[model samples]
Target: MLEPEHGLIRQVEHAHTKCWVCVLSCLLLASVYVGSLYVWRSSLPRDHPSVIKRRCASVLLVSALSPAAVKAWIHWADIRVDVSVWELMGVRLEGFVPALILPLLLTMVFYLGPLVHSAMDDPDGFTTELQSVLDVQSWRLCVRDVVWLRNQVVAPVTEELVFRGGMLPMLVPCAGPTAAIFVAPLFFGVAHLHHIIEQQRLQRDGMSVILLVAGMQFLYTTVFGAFTAFIFMRTGHIVGPVLCHSFCNSQGLPDIGFALQHRERTALLFSYLMGALLFLVLLFPLTDPFFYGAIPVCSLAPAPEPVC
Candidate 1:
């Protein structure tokens, strides 16, 4: 294959349109969703069950469903072909392995390791808090089913599209990779505060529990959010974050249940440290495109300068 004799930026300019749009959408949504979360926070009771349901629904609709629908529409209508003139062509990977896979792998290491440890520390305790408030109903099965479906399937699909697909691109131009990564997680944590508060409403002493439980949940989501953003940035694929998120969320639940059951101090500390580590890692410069790699080419590469 013929190769260009310019910086990496020159190469990316000629890449595919659909690919760029997908990446761009990820970045844009991440920022918008984060902004929306902040706006809605004060209006809702942090510990109300209805508030949690509403917040979850809002996020799901905006981040995943809407964007996916738009994508489908564009593809089906053949708008992609019409928009081809605006695309960056020739962005094929240089080798068998995607350059992004390594960075993504390392990021997973930091996110998953800590998340697992944290969940193990705070096991089934969250459940007791929920059960004590209600008459021990058979809804346990339903709750479990919903939680699994929500986290494993629904959440991953919706959240990945928003943070990684939509909002992330908006940040890349303004903040570059470093800020983009942190911003996504920060917003993710803020967004989940509603759910934590919802959990609190089920308890008698709602105010007292809200802070602790919300903080724990926030720590869990923020780390994963950052990691997912990293996946989007590196691989430029929406699926990366969804897979990582589902895997991470699935692994942590049982451990969290166990921690709640035993109420072990070691478990708590272990989980906390893991969150802290991830929090700290969020600040590090871990292979950002602008910082460490060759310049990227865009589809918008101007006509080649006439040879002087």
Candidate 2:
């Protein structure tokens, strides 16, 4: 029904709008990436008197800027920011528990399965190994550390706010869910690569070791970034990924393939492998829109009609 010139004009406007969204998203991501490095490099030790204030200020700045950026993009794109913080950021109590539990359970099954299998294989060594692992002093030290609290809590919340909450939704309109999921996480993974610089500063490791470590970290974080992005898209909330990120930080990566020698250990490994496989198999159905009432059918566009 539109005239040729009118259609052409519309197309041009759409193209320009898309370009603006992409450019703004990139700028926001770049600022967060650079800002994170500056914060890390300039931050004092946890034991220092001014550490809390400095770190708090840095986090506050990023947190403020993230939502502001999101607002700007949504406005520029002529979209509505209708989702709540829980919906937008995924912080709902309903989803958060499962999000945290599943990953932790899987990690535990993978890492502790081998050790448990080893323990079962030799009852004599079980007590010693258990005692070594259960050392109250070590547990106490970890619990008491302020740095651990910051890493587990503050970092997860803020990083998710920036990467998943701010950058991802804006990207969905332009890139769609599939591309946005992986694309936003690429920046998230790259942000952590700064750790290699920190590592280099503190340790006298050769370039090879540093590079290897950095590469591994980049790979895993990028993979995890995809996962968090998927979770964000599925739940339509930021909390899901935030809690998951914190849990992942606390648990670290599982060391697999070490208990292959003994038959019992191998069996345990197989069990865990199967469990992980099952989780992967069910992940989609479990996260499907029909399963959660809180997940609304909405699009990144400004349409009055919802897009499921």
Find the candidate with the highest lDDT and give its number.
2
lDDT of 1: 0.51
lDDT at 63, model 1? 56
Q: Candidate 2's residue-wise lDDT over 1-308, tens digit each? A: 66998999997899678767765776666577456545644434444536644665677677766666666666677765567533554545555555555544543443455445656668787776557567988667766666775677777888887778777776676666677788888887777777676667667588889999889988998988887777777766666677778867865675455556555666777766775776677666656655444553145523332222
Q: Output the worst ten-in-a-row residue range by lDDT, candidate 2.
A: 299-308
Question: TM-scores for all candidates?
Answer: 0.47, 0.75
Candidates' C-alpha lDDT: 0.51, 0.66
Model 2 TM-score (2 dp): 0.75
| Cα distance off (Å), candidate 2, residue 231 | 1.1
lDDT of 1 by residue, 120-144 (tens): 5455754564465475564455465
Cα error, candidate 1, residue 141 (Å)? 13
RMSD of each: 11.9, 5.1
Residue 36 alpha-carbon offset, candidate 1, angstroms: 11
Give the TM-score (vs. native) of candidate 1: 0.47
